[model samples]
Target: MCTYLHGPRQGGMYYFRRGIPAPLRSIIGKREFLISLGVKDREQAKRMIPQYTTETQAILDAAASHGPDTAPSPMRAAADFALWQNKQEAAEYQYQHSMEQEEAAIAREPLVSALEQKLKLSVDKLSPEEQAAKDIIDNLKFELKLSQEKRMPERAGGERPENSSNAKGQLKQSGAAGPVSSAQTSISAMYEGYATQPGLREATVRQFRSIINHLINFLGHDIANQVSSDDLIRWRQFLQKEAAVKGKPRSAQTINNSYLAAASVTFDYGFNERLIPKNPVALVGKVRAEKKIRLRSPDFTKAERKAILSASLSIDAGRRSAQLVGALRWVPWLCAYTGARVNEMTQLRREDITKIDDVWAVEITPVAGDVKTDEARLVPIHEHLIEQGFLEYIDACPEGPLFYDPDKSGVGLQRGQYKRVGMRLAEWVRGLGIGQVGDRSLQPNHAWRHTFKTICLEAGIEERAMDYMQGHASRGVGRTYGSNTLPMLQVQLAKFPRFELG
Candidate 1:
């Protein structure tokens, strides 16, 4: 029989069947009765209950309505719903698997990780200052990476597009941002220009050239333009590795000098040429070399000076061409007395020597553009120069070169001729078993300047006046009025005992 449901007096529904048991009827509340009656609202529930009861009564009256052979099982319907859910779950899992495979393929490519490896190696070997420079390079690399990622087109539902052949090409092109070859070219040009100057020698140019060339060769041509911050890091690694391989990792001082020379010239040239907007090489750190100040005086001892002069006279007597020997003998002794660089000494002329205040003095006016450091300076002659027949030598010519060339055919003392003479003098001194002349186990013309400074310092000369005498560029109080007066300089110089040269 069909069941009918009706609402409670308080507005909830209840279900009932015709001739149903009183106990079952009491258990069915109005809410459950309305749900079973398949009516969503109170009005529908009231109407549906009476109609359902009438229809159930009619069906009950027919003998075939409740036949035992026609009923459907509830368990069969539940099994069908479970199968549908399994199909939906399998479809979702397949979609997720496809996405994971795409991500794995992108990660397998080599180009993505190459730049990162390069940077890590480069930064590992730098000093603190150099590491700061590497840091800037690293930032630039990061910028390039981000820019490349931004330019990539997006896919469906905010997913990133897979890496394609065209995208890889674009990334490769973006990676070619550094200008290593240009840097090398600029450095070569700078060294060539610097070597042309009178004071900068060819050997110095060659040494700097070697350093630049080595760096260029180390970074291969194919990857030269593609130098990222990481490539520089790798270069630092290469330098240390090479040093260890050679069994002399070189002092920090040497390596520092090499790097400084490389960086300074490269950046200076790049800045001047407007190549990269700013100097990239300038970020490298400086190397600190130990500074040792020797305090012993530098005058030739009485015996040593006598032996040098005696050797000089012997050479003068034996050799027909005494110009070189004579010049060496007098110039070094003159430097001992007057304190001047070999280059400065070679530029001396008869016009520079003058008598002031009834005493002979040298008027050293460094011609405006002639000085090595590009700063002009002046120094006065000492009484010892006059006493040692220097005045007599100058008087012989009066207007030409004080140390005139009898053979007047070649260039005078410019272009390292004076340096050659100094070398010869060093060889001669070694032959006579004299004392060690200079540092580095090589005879250098600069020793004379050193010797002068040391002698003046030991004699208790004022530090400022000594600095002025040596043409050292120093700035401070009292030094502001560094006078170029011969009388004033002579007064200070006269305080030191005359340097006897035999």
Candidate 2:
């Protein structure tokens, strides 16, 4: 008498519930399939049984044939789930709802008898063709009735489950297909929970997701708890040897900072939640790289500095969009004097440049975009920048961001517009033959930050004041007590010497 129908919950809606086969659950990435029947009427719901059963079986068959090759992409899995759900809903209306002939005939008998009585006609007196059509309709109704009576016995028996909550009402699966234990939990599954943890930013969540996905792909399975420290060491080795051995991209520092860092935090989260016994990633050491002796400092060489500054001054506005031209022209200069990150300058609004107590300063605030420390600081503008018409450019610009147009950037891209400005500027600088340090490419925008801090220290500016201007976190409890006023920052900036572009 089981109908495979569930609910009549608070909303009085019914759903067709079925358990996925245990062997295929890992591949499909779910324990069961729950398709809503979208009806209060038992009869209407019963009519949908055949189509739902057929479609779901086909989906299961497809997954079984493909095996683990069908393991879901974390980025697209939610979207795919929604799309499949929509397909099921659309299929409901599209089904022909064809009835079995014998069942159809039996079901239609009463209606046929009533019609004959009302019209005062007998079937025996009908023409040959009319009689033939009548016979076919009777046979179809008979077959449809028989099919439903067999398929949905609960409807035929005039019975339904008490409610959706009861043990008897729920669809049962094999023992292996029951709730996944923490140790059996896949990294993809754990990530679903980890991704919702508070205080993580959108960019951070995105970065973590990418790292987890990469790990999943490399391991060929999503099980995080089972991954030992040995597995992690191998992953590090693979990343470092990727370029020469596997034809994949290579990085040693990135392997430590990004890859291992992401996995370590994820495992830590799992351990804290008691989802895993312990964090294995914590045991793995960083990837080792051969040391390269640098002839010059990490800062941009003086010739490189002069080339970048002089190129920025000559950047043609006619060749590029106004935002790109603006970023290319002034961001380098801003970074050179303030020691603020490149992104801080690229995200600048015209309003962010203000006169505080008659001294021009830039506000590196989270209100503009992401600040690395999530705190704002006032960076005093240098006299050299003012001399090079920086203030005139600010005044001439429109009301919004100085570097990028917000309107052109699509939804959820507010934080990324300034980032794109930095990217575009880097590409432009590369064209100018700057930012190269031997085999490595120095970050064009960041080179100025290194240059600025070095200049400040050499010019006898106080370290604390330089740190304050650059938005670096105060090192000690004592340093956190006082605020650096605009006058203090301006004094620090005064000592920074002007670049001789010749």
Candidate 3:
């Protein structure tokens, strides 16, 4: 005799087995056997036992109907089993739907492999939400096999209209084309217009060209009339994304400047040439950049000044010939005392210095036709510079620039040596373990100018007088007196105390 069991725990199926075994007694406890009948109450378990036994007996009778010697038909058995399983699954899903609508909404779509690849490409340039929508569309296409089933109507003899259909398709394609680009027109005008500014350095020109190129490439050929305010905004966002992807989002000031340069030039050209009715860039406002001031004082203290001077003189003769040391020592000291720019100091010649009423002054007016800002001014040599051996150094290099580059190759000292000297000085400072402020890695030669201003302010020198000494524009009486004369300027120069390193 065989024991029989049927319950929800057996997946709502009927089963029979001889399970009485001493070793397996713990495996199926009393509670499990009762629960297997789909009944928690003792009364319900007793009542369901007969019904379960009846179902199990029916399953056994059906199995017996298929003779032991007969082979089961695989196709018929599989189809019948699938139909029953699908119906059961549908019932289960219907029962669970009330509790899982939110979860179902978030479920992933079933997209074919090929459709997935194409959808990824199409939505690559869209935002996250748009990409999700595109994914759903791709899944629908795969589920329906829409593309494969799209067929044209058959002609009576199966002949197709070739030329006419091709012509219509071409016309449809041409009608959807984008706008044309204004690259050649705008860029050519910008380059030609600003080619003559005196202050336009080589570096500035390069930056201008770079900004124009970026705009042209991003906008493409049909960019002129097709571009709108929203397009510019999108372009800016794209630039930020590109920078972030490269691990360095450009500074806000840098982005603003680039945008201004490109947009302003293009729109201005368009407006002036009557290519457009008005300037598009005129709508954009200036980007307020953070103010950067080099307040880290480089002026040497009294002791450090002496040490540097001693180091200069004590340098191995083989390292920097004695003549070079003697020539360079007074240069750094003059820089600390007068605060003259390195370029101005390096370019100074003996003839540029003159004595007025026994007071020495340095003339810095542009020689002949070589003015930097197309304006010339005289700079007075400090009395401290004279005391620090400027007079002696002047006697040494009387004809040419005081700080001459021995390497007479390339662009020469006037342009390159100034930067080299600054770098060398920074290295020397670092070697001494003294902390430098504000970009310590690259010593700023311009710090001397700041030192000069600070010292002048500290000494209680009148603002106008100090401005005149520094060769800056002055106001009021100082402006009217306009002491362009050497003697009059000499009187004003006498007021500035000679600078001392200590």
Candidate 4:
């Protein structure tokens, strides 16, 4: 995103060029790095140079940091993949075989337990037949337990090892069992390892990857140990101030989130590995919230709801509207009825909407992507929603998100926030003049929860039941004894009065 062009050359058209650093020249196997901007006009070339410059710099940086032999060769990677496939097949076979054995053992347990109970009085005191039965049962249980332990395949050691040779090459590159991580590990190298760490959520890792990618471009082929606190400060400052000046400024929350993303993963990884003496991000301060971004509404006023519905339906209805996010049409109705999150509605597949014990419901869960509570729950589709051609919409596509394009179902930054499915929903709400509830602002697509809760509570539905419908955990003993069933939730949801958008 450099405004001024730094590298230039002439060919059939103008091209971007960079001379490889002298020390790294042999590793790159080239004197000068080059890429055509694919245009002749100065303005066109300038516009096109950023991408070409970015890509060429990336290639040069990789060569400088990792050289050519740091990672597994292509043939070696393919061989490792083959090994992994074989391991998977073997694991599948083991799993099925183990399951069969476990089933047989479980099926025999009832008879065994019964026989054992029958002989429990005393081996000698029991009848001869009962004693014999106990002996047989005891032996059967012991044999079953032992056989299971002996036959169960232990987990493969150390996650998908690259078919021995590739592993050896990697080991050789890392310096013959010197330590878990080499002293020379680059920032990029550290990120690759950290991203795969156990217990890190996939969603979180992705955020880290995004944050780290930005950091790398700033650091420029920096090694893990070479990055100083100053470097972190610059990166954080760049993200907080400079980067966004060119476009939309990242919110305080975005800045802080980016900070945490890097600190928790990249810096933490380097520190844990002893590659860096201290975490540079540990002292980084959180960005202050200078302005409010109400992502969720405290409550959608009846008037705001009407405006939203009117604007939504009035547009090129049901066609992906340019004025609003993909959900401008059906999302409001779904949110109003079910009280589900925007993503909860947007990420739903046709299969996600199915009858559970005769109650037609949408499974508002994390199957497609991350959910708020990380727990799946059932929200019965309102009769009003079904009546409004919602079922027809669902029927059209039997798979993928109901409110999003199928091809772009799983696409987006941090999970469909910036994909072709559409524009940001909050902006639409703001555009509709549905800005805030009292002091609080309405988050783009989040206010529906407030609306549903208010509506349902006023309509005689219990708060606890509403919580269940909205996928929020309920308090007290009710959660322990009371169940969250489709039929039960359907009744509470039915109490929600459907809106007349027209």
> Considering every candidate listed, which one attains the maximal TM-score?
2
Q: Decide which is better by lDDT, 2 or 4.
A: 2
Better of 1 and 3 by lDDT: 1
- Candidate 2 has an lDDT of 0.65
Task: Using lDDT as the measure, name the better of candidate 1 and candidate 4.
Answer: 4
Residues 415-467 of candidate 1: C-alpha lDDT, one tens digit per residue: 33333444455566667775454433323345556666777888888777777
Error of 3 at 500 (Å): 4.3
Task: Report every candidate's CA lDDT.
Answer: 0.46, 0.65, 0.45, 0.57
Query: Tens digit of lDDT per residue, candidate 3, span 220-285?
Result: 422343444445556666766675312555545555655555565555544334343223343233
Q: Which residue pairs in candidate 1 collide?
A: 2-56, 13-30, 14-30, 118-230, 119-230, 122-233, 122-234
Model 1 — TM-score against the truth? 0.48
- C-alpha displacement of 397 in model 3, angstroms? 2.8
User: Residue by residue across 433-452, what tens digits does model 2's lDDT show?
Assistant: 77642335366777777888
Rank order by lDDT, top first? Answer: 2, 4, 1, 3
- Our tally of clashes for model 3 stands at 8
TM-score of 3: 0.48
On lDDT, the stronger of 1 and 2 is: 2
Candidate order (TM-score): 2, 4, 1, 3
Model 3: worst 10 consecutive residues (lDDT sum): 159-168
Task: Point out the higher-scoring one by TM-score: 2 or 3.
Answer: 2
